[model samples]
Target: MRALRAGTRTLDLNRRIAVMAIVNRTPDSFYDRGATYALDAAVAAGTAAFDAGADLVDVGGVKFAPGPPVPVEEECARVIPVVEALAPHGLVSVDTFHPEVAVAAMAAGAAVINDTTGLHDPRMADVVAAGNAALVIAHSLAAPRTQHPLPHYDDVVADVLAFLRDRVALATAHGVPEDRIIVDPGHDLNKNTRQTLELTRRLGEFQELDLPLLVALSNKDFIGETLDRERGDRLPGSLAAAAWCVAHGARLVRVHNVRETVDAMRMIEAIEGWREPVYELHNTRPEGND
Candidate 1:
């Protein structure tokens, strides 16, 4: 696995999975609504997430829930302030697809751009390249703020892999280095329950891409449906999915419950060390020699 550089900090993938705490700056985000919509609340949430062992905090504007589109200026206004406030403490990732928002957030000291649009916006790549910021090219089949109907895939894993591969290639061709890129499968972005499960089950397939993989499976609707829980009650399922992702070679996990997820990951890491066979051969000889 390649070393993922978020600003001056570099995460060695073989060591452990990086935990990214979600800090929603919008009022209507599916999870953590109103948790940090205001500047003061945003700062407090960021501090708590960092204290809870988050390697990065992803701040987002323009809630992506099914609704009318928010103007680009409003989106920028909502997120840039939070980014600016949290810039000094740790790595901050701006989750926005608009090129203008990307530019503004970077100016506010965000080190990464977590674009759900997969760099579909022509100018988004250029903005990221110009800022020398790390880019997360996430797979999503439809635009934000609209209901994504159930989409079909002949092979869900293969299709997701190909889509992410193509997006990474496009970004690289536009001057973004491979080291500065991360790919996400975009869980629940445009998938049905089965498709989401298949993607999660086969996440290891993306390891062949030779880039760090990020799984955003925090409180998504698919988890809610699978476990028969409301959106707020999906923490256990989310933690389980996160552990599964880590075992399958995921390098980054974007989640809402920072402290709990961090604890779960630590426990998983400890258990992971035990998975290797511990017995060693004492003085042994070939059968014929013996």
Candidate 2:
């Protein structure tokens, strides 16, 4: 039985799956682009997701893809208000690799720091430890905002496992407790579609990390390419991949579609015997037999 403690929200991953709904404040993010870039829209999106069944909300000001550099101050500006506003609703995780932004977000009420760059700046870990905030150390082979063309790996899963193991140790050594840390395989971050699919297939191996595993697979190119579908039409594939990962051992799923992901996860949990039906009296008896 594993539990993830993000501020006051503790999730028992043993019997349930946690949904981290995406609330990107960046205007150029692959999904939703500038839809939620506005402060009001972003907050509304977060609030709506929470109402729809999200366990946590991840707020990011910068896109992971290579783009014009957003200064630390600008990044802070983009997410601080959203974090301060959303913190009271539930757990809010600020996505950034810069230690300065991380600390600011923490001060503004963010309970978790989701660094997609695999904690590239070691100082980021110290900030998390200082605030007693949860840290999400994701595996990314390239630096932030930099492209890695045709990145090759001897074994994608094995390599990712090794990288995460080392990063976990580094984070713990920097004063962040193991229980306060979550690891993300970072599908499609640096790896191509094939590697991302492999990670999805063998996600159970990440369980060895002994901590909650987060997979950010919402409308990613891997699903789109595999199904020959566009971003807007990849919900089915995304849900299918998410269900597979949930069955394989992913504890948290970062997604764009909250309702569908929640429904799929609940269904999967029921199938896995980790959850029970809310109403068991649905047509169990034959017509007029009851």
Q: For residues 1-290, write the lDDT of model 1, one tens digit per residue.
A: 88887776777877777899888888887777677888889889998999899989999887655788889999988888888888899999999889999998888889899998788786788888888679999998877667778698999999988998899888988888898999999898888888999999988999999999999999998899999999889999999999998889898999999999988877777677833334535445454432
Q: Assess each prediction's global lDDT (C-alpha) against the native.
A: 0.86, 0.91
36-96: candidate 2 lDDT, tens digit per residue: 9999999999999999999889999999998778999999999999999999999899999
**Could you give the C-alpha RMSD of every candidate to the true structure, in order shown?**
6.5, 1.5
TM-score for each of the candidates: 0.91, 0.96
Which regions in candidate 1 have their CA more than 4 angstroms from the true location?
A: 273-290
Q: Report the Cα lDDT for residue 226, model 1.
A: 93
What is the number of backbone collisions in each predicted candidate, taken in the order shown?
Answer: 0, 0
TM-score of 1: 0.91
Error of 2 at 120 (Å): 0.6
